[model samples]
Target: MSILITGATGLLGRAIYAQCQAQFPTLDIIGTGFSRAQAPLVQLDLNDAAAVRAFFAKYQPSVVIHAAAERKPDVCENDPEQTLALNVETSRLLAELCHEQQSRLFFISTDYVFDGKNAPYAENATPNPLNFYGKSKMMAEQAIVAINPSHTIIRVPVLYGEVEYLAESAVTVIAQQIQQNPQSSHDHWAVRYPTHVADVAQTIADLIALPAAQSAGIFHVSDSQAMTKYDMACVIAAALGQNASSLVAVPEPTQSAARPYNCALKDTRLKQLGIVHSRKFDVAIQQIITRS
Candidate 1:
């Protein structure tokens, strides 16, 4: 049984692929992406529907783990049509293709589906996205469900680690400040779920191994804690053996792309499935720092 992983070169996707390879070495993993160093890339562009169909028809993968998307909120807001086309339209096309191929699709979603006014969103909560990016993702989620009932949409929140997206979003940002001025205390206040990318990826791999009846639905993947941007910086600082109190809270962005303050999601359903991980925020931080 071969599994097709899109965005295999991405931070989360690569992490998931690595963990899956470790756990299920015998499973055929067809890693696909445009990047050469993305490790087993298929050179498949999502926008090209015919190409996507051709690739799926050729592979006929039984399990599809789709972790690709235009994730940046500001980028999405800057180009709504492009964002919708990439995030929504591409997913719609993939869902249809996966249905025809008889593949079990597991699409990555975000906690941003909720406006953040409500913290610890549940699996069944009504999505009230406050921004265009969230709207597009929620649209994709709904569309994926409509296209294939066998699909599993996993919603993860503000992910970080020693790897790809973390460097861009959290690790590098904190390390830069620490390197520049070990005493600088600014740029904080954005709160998030702060999930470990490796953990989220492993959770996906675990869910896919479960029986179809058990893993098919919406699942919120995140840490057990809710933290502000400052909190995250503190974690990073502590992990790097720096001073946490050296960082200070700054005013958050009022209106730019879109971010949910309380997008922290509860993993109750995943917990019920005995799918637990290192919920200790410090453990995840330490892991990232060690590898960083």
Candidate 2:
């Protein structure tokens, strides 16, 4: 079987692709990236409809993991047009093509779909996005489900893991701040579930290996650890042998893009499937920081 992975060079995509390679060694795993595509990953612009169609026809990947999207809330807020095109339109196109090709699609979504007023959102929970990034992802989720209800959709919260750079991940950036300035102030208002990318990757691989009867529909894959930027900084500070008390905590929402106070995703579906892959943030993050 051939599997296709989009955004293969990204923080989460890289982990997903790696997991697929390790778990399904015999299957053909084709990866795609835009600006950073290298050998084993073809440079394909998802927006080019003709090109995307041609590539799909050539590869005919039996399973398609649609992970490419504009994930930054502030960036999406600033350029709604680009966000819609990349996050919504491209996803819609992928769903259509996957249906035509008889390929099962696994669309990546976000916990940001909820307004943050609600905690531990269910797989079928109603979406009330507070920002463009979340709205675009919610739109993509709807379009994918409309085209094919059997297709799987996985929604995760903020992710961190092995990264090419420290600043590449929202969680790892805390370490950067701690390294740069001991007195840096971090947001203590918003609560987040900073999941490890490797865990999310393993969950996807497990889902793909499931029987056809149990593989379809939406699934939430997230860590249970609830933390804020300040909390993360404290952990990161401990890892770096720095003083956690040196950092300042701002007890209010920060950042240009609106963030949810606590969009904790309830992974009841995955749990029911006996698919569990989680690590303590304090433990896993220390390894991540050490590697970086």
Candidate 3:
């Protein structure tokens, strides 16, 4: 049976596809995308219910990885209605289709589902989203659970990798900045869990490879350790063999969307599933550096 992945053109989706291809070489993988990429893609828009339903019917995916979302907090803030329409409503449609097909749905969620007042939120913690993006994601989570009780909701932290667009990734952006301005000091202040897309992808692929009974319900996927944005910058710098001091601390910039200071997640469930994430910040940074 094929594993169908939505948002295959995006970073997370692409990473998941890559990991699946590497780990499960003989498994069939179908990728859907809004914009075309190197992978085989079915160009179907999630917002268009007809297109999505048709894709679902034709593909008949046994495993559906829902990685598509309007995740930019600022963009979602600017257009809350669009965010809801794309993230929540579209998700409901997909969940319904998955249920009809009896496919296991792995829904990608966010740490932003929390209010950020508490660090390292648990899987069972009540989600009180502090921003529009968070609200939309939370809505999707609820809708998916309502539609398909067999779904797996995987909540992830902010991701960074080498192959990214718009300089949106913290790790990539910091690495580039350090390369350009090796002597500048603005890298040590911003810190996050900084989960590598590869690790996140690996975890998801591993889950999908498991039996249905082994893969169900919500799972928090994050690093074992939580680091600030500043700490991430220092790691990036050190990986490049540059002076970590060159990455200086800067005041927190104003954000259009509310940020949860405590967006970190604890992955006790993932650990129990034998998927312990022990990638240190330095090792993750080096991976990015090597790949970059």
Candidate 4:
């Protein structure tokens, strides 16, 4: 079987591509990035409809994992048109192509779709996005479902993992800040279940192995443990053998785009599939630090 992965140069996409190659050695895998001319990733801009159509025609992949998006909430809020073009329009195009090719499209979504009012959101939770980024993703999900009900949608929380670049993951960004200035402060209000990208990749592989009867619809791939940014910073500091005592806890600051206060997702469906093996927050953080 052939698989096509978009945003292959990104954190989660890269991890998914690597894990798929390692686990399914005989499978044909094609990765695409916007401008990256890397060996494994071809330069294909999803915004270009003609180019994307040509790519799908050439590859005719059995599975298409749509992982590219304008993820920054503030940036999306600032440029709603661009956000819609990149997040929603690209996804719609890919969904149409995948449907024509009879390929399973795995769209990577985010937990930000939930309104922070609820604690742990389930797969069936109603999405009330507070920011344009989340709204775009929700629209994409709806479009994909309308086009192809058998497609898979995986919603993940804040992700941190082994990155090609040091500052790619938010966890590593925090580590860099702590290293620069041990006396740093972080938001104590916003809560998130920071999941490892490797775990997300493994979940994708497992889903692929499952029968079509089992692997359709939305699945949450989040860590069970939820913590505040302050808590995450402390964990990073501790893992790096730095003094977290110097870190101060501050209230969540206002942003151009409002973020969910507690967008922790519950992986009930994934657990039901018997494929949920999320690593502990501390353990994952330590591993990332050690690897860095």
Among the numbered candidates, top lDDT falls to 2
CA deviation > 4 Å runs, candidate 3:
164-168, 179-191, 251-253
Tens digit per residue, CA lDDT, model 4, 195-291:
8999999999899878865889999998877788889999999998988999989887566789889988888988777887677888877887788
lDDT of 3 by residue, 199-256 (tens): 8898998898888878888899887566666676677777888887766676664576
Candidate number achieving the greatest TM-score relative to the actual structure: 2
* TM-score, per-candidate, Cα-based: 0.91, 0.99, 0.90, 0.96
How high is the lDDT of residue 17 in model 1? 77
- Superposition error at 183 for model 1 (Å): 5.2
How do the residues 117-186 of candidate 1 rate in per-residue lDDT, one tens digit apiece?
A: 8776889999999888899999999999998776999998877765643346544466667657767665
TM-score for candidate 4: 0.96
Better of 2 and 3 by lDDT: 2
Can you tell me which runs of candidate 1 are displaced by over 4 Å?
36-39, 164-166, 181-188
Ranking by TM-score: 2, 4, 1, 3
The alpha-carbon deviation from the true structure for residue 6 of candidate 2, after best TM-score superposition, in angstroms, is 0.1
Question: Comparing candidate 2 with candidate 4, which one achieves the higher lDDT?
Answer: 2
